[model samples]
Target: MAGSAEGFKEFATSCSGRLFRTAWLLTGDWHLAEDLVQETLGKVYRAWTKRSRPDDPVAYARTTLVRTFITHRRRRGSAERPSDALPDLPAGETDVALRVTLIDTLARLDAKDRAVLVLRYWEDRSVDETAAELGLSAGAVRSRSFRALDRLRAVLGTDGLTPTTQNEVS
Candidate 1:
């Protein structure tokens, strides 16, 4: 009741930013990322009463956000059309050029490839853990991880958009 509500509030407050970062990487669009985070939080809240809350609600929320992004991408309107002009980066965002390059590269990737990369590298998740989250075999995760990185390297090199240091961006 009240206790459950309070716990959820705290969890959401602490985890929402992390979840939104994952969502943004998944979506490549801020508005869609916000929607995905809200949807994930709603799902977590709905399940809170039926089962004990996850030991790591942040992990739980991330899984939900990834799955929700996957589902959304399957829908009819989810295919994005390329735009000529880049959207303005959020104010005070650091590493503007690097972030823009990463987001652009990520957007070019297939949804599953992007998901595998984000989970494995961006989140620094283990192969087995990412496999479990995406319901793939560990071998599959490994293969995808290799291919995704190779693609990024190829693209960055050809475009001359390589960052000095590759940081695991949110």
Candidate 2:
């Protein structure tokens, strides 16, 4: 029992930051992200003791976070209304401006679509891995990815980075 608890702690300590980042990106709010991370870790800790092999703990944690976010969004209504306008970027700054634009654009996306973008681009997960993590089929993942990218391009303007029709995000 003690050994299992210790093992769980070790895993949590190592993966918590990455998990939190994923949660933050999913929720678009720091406080909500923290709560989601806590909930995910609690569930992971509970499962850690009973699992046989516990391979790919990161993947397990990520799947838990995604499911938790999806459930919460469903219960609270699908659309999230931002109370304030997006923050403005300083003039003549390209990187920061682009990042701010991207964040604002991402905030506008549907929860599941945003999850697909984060998993595919930020986490650099392959289609198969993303599909498995979200319990989606490969074709579904591809379609969702395409749609998300298209939405992003529309939001960011066609002048910004546009996803290729060949299924590659630019």
lDDT of 2 at 155: 78
Compose the digit string of candidate 2's lDDT tens values, residues 97-156: 767778788899988888888898868899999999999999998999999988888877
lDDT of each: 0.82, 0.82
**Count: clashes, candidate 1:** 0
- Measured against the true structure, the TM-scores of the candidates, in listed sequence, are 0.45, 0.44
Quote the lDDT for 145 in model 1: 83
Point out the worst 10-residue segment of candidate 1 by lDDT.
159-168
Stretches off by above 4 angstroms in model 2 are 1-3, 51-53, 77-170
- Which candidate number has the best TM-score? 1
